[model samples]
Target: MVEAATIGYTSFPGYPEPPYALVYARPDRADTAIGNFLHGLDLADYHVALERMHIGARVSAVFAAERSALVTDFHWVLDD
Candidate 1:
């Protein structure tokens, strides 16, 4: 499953809520494999991925756990 989250948001004229970002976790969390997969990804990549799914999402930030593979957080926003 995809772990989607957001801390703050901004509303648009025709939108229902605020804008946010997205996180792609793997093996149930944001582990080394997941981090590695997203390591080289840029803002464009993130936007493209979200857009392909028809989501008006923007990645605010990506938090990774360097010491613990079991600890990770993904910040994102959704259109609906």
Candidate 2:
């Protein structure tokens, strides 16, 4: 993964923002896998995502694959 600060963002014809910038995936470092993960989750609820991420001692997430990533200290609430 190459590391560089985001110079700018490019958006497509229609979408909230074309996902051109980084909100979490190390904006200073250009990790391809990290970038892809962030982009893939564009439609996810930011508040819920952050809430899930915050239960830890410190918030952290690691993605080996998009379907599941390692998140620290997160608790799950199940629905019946």
Candidate 3:
């Protein structure tokens, strides 16, 4: 499975929702491993992996959609 995480984000009244960065990984590697691992999938896959193995980690933008205020920054750890 592929783990897609939103490392960070940015938002404002006149600014687009920045995609930020996503740390990508996979279970196994083989011929065309990258294509098979990353392609022919959707974001929901990440959610599933996150629930099952807690493989994915995300730190959203510090912006509150409702109040348009920046929230506190977020951090995480990965050791496996």
Candidate 4:
């Protein structure tokens, strides 16, 4: 898994504001299998309030067999 965080005030056209923990997986076909284990978690509640917190968020990816790349899928949720 590759983890990244926003460095500055960044914004996408339809996405949330800065301060996002982006996580994705790029496993070798021989080492890792494809399954729900690759999915991430949802920690928006903690992320918004804490500056240095653990990386946990619900994530999904669209694999491109042609290019062998993981396309990041993002979703926002409010925890109760």
lDDT on C-alpha atoms for all candidate structures: 0.35, 0.31, 0.32, 0.34
Model 1 lDDT vs. the true structure?
Answer: 0.35
Determine the C-alpha RMSD for candidate 4 after optimal superposition of all C-alphas.
Answer: 8.2
Candidate 4: tens digits of C-alpha lDDT, residues 1-80: 22333322467674445544343323334354222222223335555533332234323444444662332332222122
Task: Pick the TM-score winner.
Answer: 4
Ranking of models by lDDT: 1, 4, 3, 2
Cα lDDT tens digits, model 2, 1-80, are 21221212466563236433233333224343232222223225555544433322121244343443344222222111
Per-model TM-score, in order, reads 0.23, 0.21, 0.21, 0.27
lDDT string for model 1 (1-80, tens) is 23442222466564333333334433333453222112222234545644442322222334555435432343232222
Comparing 1 and 2 by TM-score, which wins?
Answer: 1
Q: In candidate 3, what residue range of length 10 has the lowest lDDT sum?
A: 32-41
lDDT of 2: 0.31
Model 4 stretches astray by more than 4 angstroms: 3-8, 28-80
Question: What are the per-model C-alpha RMSD values against the true structure?
Answer: 10.7, 11.3, 14.4, 8.2
How far out, in Å, is residue 3 in model 4? Answer: 6.7
